[model samples]
Target: MNTVPVNFDFSVSSVEVARRLIGVTVLVNGVGGRIVETEAYDREDPASHSFAGPTSRNITMFGACGHAYVYRSYGIHWCLNFVCREEGHGAGVLIRALEPNTGIELMQKRRGMETLRLLCAGPGRLCQALGVTREHDGMRLNTAPFELLLPDQPVAEADIVAGARIGISKAVDIPWRFGLAGSRFLSRPFGRSHK
Candidate 1:
């Protein structure tokens, strides 16, 4: 079913929708590479995490728009987001890390580990090397093959670099986390001692 091209357009330009989602490619079909290292959760500020509005596990971040909001952090990690403002507005953008490309032996046997940059880097190791659970909570990021591909060179807001958010304690200062600076598959830099 690899015909590609389904992008459920969401009226882009949220900071170019977070720097056009860097080298876009997040394949987890059979499990492997599709390098992705995202992190841009800004919704007119208020220190996001849906800025305390939609309940019931962030009601798919207010629904409609390119969805997919699997949550479950600190209770044993499982955070993968991408539901940006539109249907009702709440905003999203938190993939975190990935760079497997095409099933590195089922992502090193589901991240049992053998080092491949410790498989996926962050966001709970890219949702445990792309098995993204919590029942794929609120899926709809363009469907089939769990999609989100738009690369060809599109990550440059001066190469991005925002702060805050990482093991959050709440609002920390609201710098709106974003990355890619020296991207070794970012997500492990937190608030830099508040600069």
Candidate 2:
């Protein structure tokens, strides 16, 4: 693939950014892979962390775009999100899953498993496999330990799938989830009419 001098313009809507991230490569210290699944959330969305306004945990989401908003999920696993929209917009795209393409051995070791498909199949799992933690929060995506490389070409719209986000009680029907079509690495399969 052709590597170009490009940066993700996170000043757009979270849904737009999430959909466009399908084929991008997210390497956390050279350990990530093609982005396969993502979910979008905005300040107005009830399911968004910023819906209730900025808090200590979600302040990063209100900061400048193109920054990391890492947070712990269920008091256990850490989840990674890319802050999007304009400054103080409080929008972000959650990186739900990835197709492991680099540092396979290291990822397997970190996750304590050898299954390739299972290594980065979920947000928490992906974070664990790539060593993403609180330290990565508020960090610039273009800086060290965070290399978000654009795809050689834009991913075709026909090759993408959309669906409702997973594991959320509110806004359960909003079609904010996006993923590469037929990607086995998705956190979960898209449901009917979700495309």
Candidate 3:
């Protein structure tokens, strides 16, 4: 219910900047949605998409800060990403999951489910629930309507845990993924470290 002041929009050029998005809150109001769970994926890391360098699919990541870079995976499953770092920097934060709040009916209708966990539980699911599509690519997060607003109280780095990214085979060696600790809203526990 509390709105926080807008700081310098995060520069999406650096992977380190993207990895720090763990505690940030993503808000979608037009559809009556508030998402809480997220996992940060830094650039420069071999596991990151930007690490392979920017392509037409990833150009938004190389642009200015505070924007969306929604993309589809395997010709299905739309994934939501938040641009990070300064303009021209090829870094962005991948929103891996979310905890739904508000508009249970709308979310359920969109997702075609009634279970609480099924609504906005994973990146693709979250995107589906909030009506995020490829059309939302490159939208500014700090502008209005749709934005990734950080809460007045951050979850803190110490409280976050790191582990290998899910559903990725390449660069699994890099431990750059970050998520909230002990949150059922999280996609899954990352081995024993997360427990």
Candidate 4:
């Protein structure tokens, strides 16, 4: 039987929701991975796609919480975000990185690299590894082909680290980016194509 919670905490603010997601296992298709990094975005934040209100592109951000809001970045790679907060609240938490748990070969094939860390170490890379795209937008995260398996308990605050989100100019001081402390799966702060 599946041990993951069917309902994740979606009532909390984007920041809290991001913090709570660390350590949860995300399953897509036949592959699964532990979510190691995340970034929170709320309507109030200028960096959020919903900040200027929903458009045809961000419709999924206004639907249900705990749903995937996959979108392409720079027309080159797809990024994955989890819709959060109340229905219509317009909030999302980006799944910035993950630790591959299954189907490494497929992930490598999709990402075009064999390095374990690079397989799913960034928002784009993770989505590419899982074959997620705008087509998967609005898909329920607790169901098949897109599942989230919660941990027994939230990762301890001490084991978690907060930092400013990368590659964004506005709301740069919010410190909404969260990652498992010392985790190798976090999108590296330095180096090209890292953020």
RMSD of each: 15.5, 1.9, 3.0, 3.4
What candidate 1 gets wrong by more than 4 Å, as runs, is 1-27, 32-40, 46-63, 68-81, 88-90, 98-102, 106-114, 122-139, 147-172, 175-186, 189-195
Please, what is the TM-score per model? 0.32, 0.96, 0.84, 0.92
Candidate 3 TM-score, C-alpha based: 0.84
- Residue 128 of model 1 has an lDDT of 85
Q: Model 4 compared with the native: what TM-score? A: 0.92
Candidate 3 residue lDDT tens string, 98-185: 7676676888899999887667777888888888888889887765557555656766766777776677777775555666776677
Candidate 1 — what's its lDDT? 0.66
Top candidate (TM-score)? 2
Per-residue lDDT of 99-174 in model 4, one digit per residue for the tens?
Answer: 9988999998988999998889889899989989888899887677876777777788878888888879898877
Residue lDDT tens for model 2, 79-138: 999999999889999999999999999999999999988899999999999999999999
Better of 1 and 3 by TM-score: 3
Rank candidates by TM-score, best first.
2, 4, 3, 1
Candidate 2 positional error at 77, Å: 0.3
Clash pairs (backbone) in predicted model 2: none
lDDT of 1 by residue, 88-115 (tens): 7777777777666777777777878867
Q: Cα miss at 126, model 3 (Å)?
A: 0.7
Error in Å for residue 179 of model 4: 0.4
| Candidate 4: clashing pairs of residues | none
**Can you tell me which runs of candidate 4 are displaced by over 4 Å?**
1-4, 189-195
